[model samples]
Target: MASSDEEKLSQQKEILNLQSQEVDEEYSKLSAILPWDKFSNWINCMCVITFDLELGQAMELIYPGHIKLTEREKSNICYLSFPDSNSGCMGDTQFSFRIRQCPGRVKPMCASHINYNHNCPVALQIDPGHYFGYVYFRQVRDHTLRRGYFQKSVVIISRLPFHNLFMHMVGVIAPEYFDNGEPSIEVACHDIDQWPTPEAGATLNLPLMGTVLQVRVPSHSDKPGLSQNLVVTTESAFSSPTIMPSVNDSDVFKCLFPILPHIQLIWELVLTGEPVVVMANSPTVCSETVLALVSMILPLRFCSDYRQFFTIHDSEFKEYTSRAQAPPPVILGVTNPFFAKTLQHWPHIVRIGDHVPATSNVKPHKLKKGGSLKTLDSKPGVYTRYKPFLNKDKAVLKRLVQGIQTNRPSEVQSAMLRRHFLEVTQSFMIPLERYVASLMPLLRNISPYKGTPRTRPFDPDEFLKSLDFSGPQLTTGIKGDWIGLYRRFFRCANFEGWYNTRIREVNRKLQLLHLEAMSDADLQSWVSGREEVEVVDLILKIKEKLTTASSNHLPVSKDVGEKLYKQMDAVIYTLPEDLRAVLGSN
Candidate 1:
């Protein structure tokens, strides 16, 4: 009797200890919900631009000023040029901003405009998130003439065949300049024309690796301009920022790696729905890093619209020519003085041109056995070979996820963790998607035959063997079993006609239930201990329905029904014995 009393006391003590722990957990969770003021700071909008540049190139930003301002009123102009990174070279790209005082006075009205008293409709004002600008011409007297807004599609198409390269360069470089509290930027014609041209005078032969030039803006008196066209010149001997010299792709990545975290931070802090554009003339930039970072940090919609990249060299130019096409000439837009003349020794290094054409001729031996085949529509030598890489990447990702879960990491890792994670995910998605697309033609399709639905004949097992299903979520516990069940239901069958019909029916009903349950957020509740009817109970209910249908003299056979029942039972038995017995008996 004394022992029984002691046991009861111990049981009560254990119950009380569990309750205390639960209460403490609840309090900790509540504490994590910060007050309203803390989250308010994250919502504040900011704009940012991230420039990807090489050693010699530089972007010059000339802010618009009131035309009426005299030479004395203009702010102190700083003429800056960075020194070469290597011996007698300007390599590093730097970021700097200056505040220009706007002239307060409004411009005098035109004499014709004063007499007519008409509103000026020609002014171009772009919306906040847009990135491009347009111009339309019209006569003043035409009654039918209407104003047209700039269409992004038209602008993009017009810029092609070099559109791809130009836009990609813009995507990488423009964000840095325009993310400063502005939705859009005025991409003027002069801006494109004024790209730093290679000139001997631009380079400063300095001992230091980094150089910043501070000079006064040349006044009108220095040049005495405004004769026929605009020829604004810098009074100081120094030139605008020069383009960076050509380095290997690996070196470019290394230079940009440290700045990625900061770039992410800037995007987070500055972005408040308004898009940004940064202006810079980078000679060589990595498209992989640029697109990956944009997809991760910006909204997903940017992927379709903003993602672009430029490549100076095409590895497989021959494959492209089979479609009866000619490559565009590479246009060297950089008027920056030193780029062309100084780098003449490097013939292999074509700095920036839209078209440097290559021949598509192939040797007769590579065509076929004993020269039997002369031409091939699809080039076997240059086809997309991505499946092997996709499988490898998927396997590595699965291992990475397993490692993370097993080790259980602590917070306070490096800031680049998120960036790296994004890079991996983006990198995996590209090749995997390509591989899947390549297999689409081989996928079986269902067709109707004599008023009955017939599934196309294919070896489901063989197809499964070809696929790489190593994704972490697709390879674990219940989810993994579900995938196997889907595969087996199609591939494995004792009775072809009856089993296929019944199993398909059951599959459809289960799919509907799953969609409904998931949509209503009741999937967890249905499977939880609190629910009287679990998934097994639902399966049993389906079994009862099938039994009833069979009794009505349906096409389904008793043996086929029995086989499916066994399969369902197998699934149930895979669970804990206690849960299975309770659910199965029901």
Candidate 2:
């Protein structure tokens, strides 16, 4: 009877103890552990140009203003120049080289802009991400009408070709500059020329890189004209921000990497729904894919359109051949001062113009008995090409989705799957857009000990009480520190990334359960228990710590996680002979 009475009392006291825990959790709301989330990636883009005669020498130079290369990247540069097809540039020579181990910008050209595209026959293109600002060209001269203007095609670059272009220069219009809807910048033509320069285009003396320059409408002379309304403060001076893969301004790709202006321009178009002139012979579909990325998707992730950038290099490419041998020229349209040829990967290297190498007339030896030549095999028939759905054909949203299922284009003309892809890129940007929002301390309602979706149950207050922690939430503070960096990387990943997907699953599970009804007390207990993993949250925690730790010094926990990993690796590398034999004893 005495023992039974004691057992009853113990049960009642345990219940009462739990009740006390609930009360403490209610009143003693200590800050939760911080979420650590940090991530990073490189934003890459490219550009291409076709003009009369390809760049003369093997080395080339291009300037896409917003992107600058870092000193470290100066070494990966390679420039490959190839010979023009059977035809020769009218008085112009065609020469080319393959990119090898050269660094810096490599601008190729000779001493003329003629009808070289028709003459220089063969061309080889390298993928954009391989090296920055890898340019290809076909020069066209028009003395019949515009005297000597060249037409060039600009292309945005990708790790592979067909990716959208990125912009190196951005036209910034600050709030003070926008009194009305117009920008403070006033553009005018110095030697007024029309688009395409079709008829008697004004022959203007352009800057070194070779494109025509436009005069400003609000021409406050550099020499301070009378009636100056312009307020040129030291801060507001026209200090052009360089755009490119320069070390100082690099993100994921190294600094000094050369992504061209045209490539950068294309990426901007995709991210912001801007329209690029889709060339008839475009390698990949641009407009449709861009719409899927920037407008519909960017908004989903909180990404916004920023500045507009361009490269003076592409503009100068118009007459690259004429100026190739006339001293390596600077990119035209770049507002900055002259840059050195040393900035190019090669040191003043020029493709010695192609001339007939002296050949001696000699008799050829007969073929060996076993090596009789055979006639060429019958020419293989061309395979049926996968056609893409035109954006015009997919003007509506519903049609766009259906088109993704039907018109499947790949390798160069592949925006046929835009409807499906757009959603992901949109999701990828959320991490960046939500950087500040996710860290607000007041909004977190999920209890850590309760582990609603993933953790096992534990008495929230009791577990915390036994921890012997005199410190502020070590994990939580660390999380707070990295929230911004993590969010940025998360959003950039389009939510399809591994971490983003796991988090979505957790949120979904929470929504399914009536988790709101559970008190903070219940949630806290759950978090403390082992039921939930909260993998994304855990990863963020690690990321937060990793930020301060050297990459080599990431922390290793000694909990079951550490043990499980060790057990796994142990199986791979068998135990010592004695230890393996001793397993039976256990």
* lDDT, each prediction: 0.28, 0.25
lDDT of 1 by residue, 305-386 (tens): 2212221121222321122442221111121223323222211111221111111221111111121112322122111111
Off-target runs (Cα >4 Å) in candidate 2 are 1-129, 132-141, 144-165, 168-280, 284-549, 553-586
Give the RMSD in angstroms, all C-alphas superposed, for model 1. Answer: 29.4
lDDT of 2 by residue, 1-586 (tens): 9999999999999999999999878656531211101000111222223333444222232222234544323222221111123222242221111111124453342111111211211111222223322223334566863537443322222221111212211112112122332122111111111222111112222111112222111111222111112111123245542222211111111100111112222232233322121110111111221222232232232122211111123222333323245422111111111211212221111111112211123111111122111222211111111111112112332343343345422211123223223333333333332332232223255543233344232232443333234211332221121222222333333333333433543344443231232221232233343322342243233333334332322233334234433432343224345643443233
Candidates in order, TM-scores: namely 0.17, 0.21
Please list the residue runs of candidate 1 whose C-alpha ends up more than 4 Å from where it truly belongs after superposition. Answer: 1-281, 284-351, 354-586
**Candidate 1 global TM-score:** 0.17
RMSD of each: 29.4, 29.3
lDDT leader: 1
